[model samples]
Target: MRLLLISNSTMAGEEYLDYPKNNIKDFLGDKPVKALFIPYAGVTVSFDEYEAKVKAKFNEVGHDIVSIHHFEDPVKAVEEAEAIVVGGGSTWNMLHLVHKNNLTEAIRKRVISENVPYIGWSAGSNLACPTIKTTNDMPIIDPLGFDALNLIPFQINPHYLDKNPDGHGGETREDRINEFMVVNTDMYVAGLREGSMFLVENGKINLIGKLNCRIFKNNVQAYELSPKDDFNFLLK
Candidate 1:
């Protein structure tokens, strides 16, 4: 199983995917690959519009993508795909559609068995965990169940922030994650900061950006790990 799980798509003041275009290019390699894109998470935008936006960026990086919406049989599409790229939006909507289409197992089989490359950001990253219960998105829709792709053993709180905005007395991101830890005691959750990502290939994992990834567990105090640190333990 290979995954490039990004924290967020765009950085502040930058164009869409500009920060990770090179990373995506390098991951896909010099040989151009027309990846299969899953665009159901894009609720605010039409699937076609989302596809065009992402397609443009992939093309710029010497890779290409065709949205799965264009296919009649989504399962067959996943089976034939060389690569899978899931874009960020509403986690609920994304998983809802995945369940509705009965694609959960199909995708897992293809990526794990065939070693097909899988890339995702934001909500897409959330889908790679054992379950989507750690997602920060509102429950706009029932995802049928909380179970996700389970491509990775741990959960990822993408676009993770250290604190709440100015003047707000609401609970910080850490507080919420602490709440999750209270119940899912044995699981690991990585607070993946913006502009950073996790690269998991074979059985090894590595952090790919300059930002330090925050780690959280039930009883352990939360701490930061830089890109230089080994993240392989999270896989266990």
Candidate 2:
């Protein structure tokens, strides 16, 4: 299986997808691919607008994408897609639509069994995990099920922050993750900081970008891992 799970789409003071455009280009290779884009997570923006923005970025990198909403049979679209790209927004709405369209299994089979390259950021990245329990978004709508694509064995907390803002008397991100660990003791959760991402291909996993990823597991102290360190252990 091949996956490019990004922590977030944009960095502060940067254009949308500006930081990862080259990474996306490199991952797609010299050959241009017209990947099928999943824009279900979008709520505030229309699918046409979302696809246009993403299409512009991919076009800048010599690739292109067509949103799945344009297709009548979404499953067939997934089956015939050369690559799949999922954009970030509301994970709840995304999963709700995905389940409503019966796309979970089709996507799973396409990426896991057929070796299609899968790229996702933020909420899209969350869908790559075993469940969306690690998402930072509020539960605005029912996701129908907590389960996600399960493309990766571990969970990813995207846009992970080290501390809460000043004067905020709420649980820190770590505290919430600690609560999650109490029940899901067997799973591993990676606090994927902004501007960071994980690359998984051919049974090996690597961390990208400068920021270190914070790892959490039950009974073990949460730790930081730099890009130079081996992340393949998380695959197990």
For model 2, what is the C-alpha lDDT against the true structure? 0.97
* RMSD, every candidate, angstroms: 0.6, 0.6
Off by over 4 Å in 2: none
Question: Scored by CA lDDT, what does every candidate get?
Answer: 0.95, 0.97
lDDT of 1 by residue, 132-153 (tens): 9888889999999999999999
Clashing pairs in 2: none
Residue pairs of candidate 1 with colliding backbone atoms = none
User: Can you write out model 2's per-residue Cα lDDT over 71-109, one digit (the tens) per residue?
Assistant: 999999999999999999999999999999999999999
Error of 2 at 182 (Å): 0.3
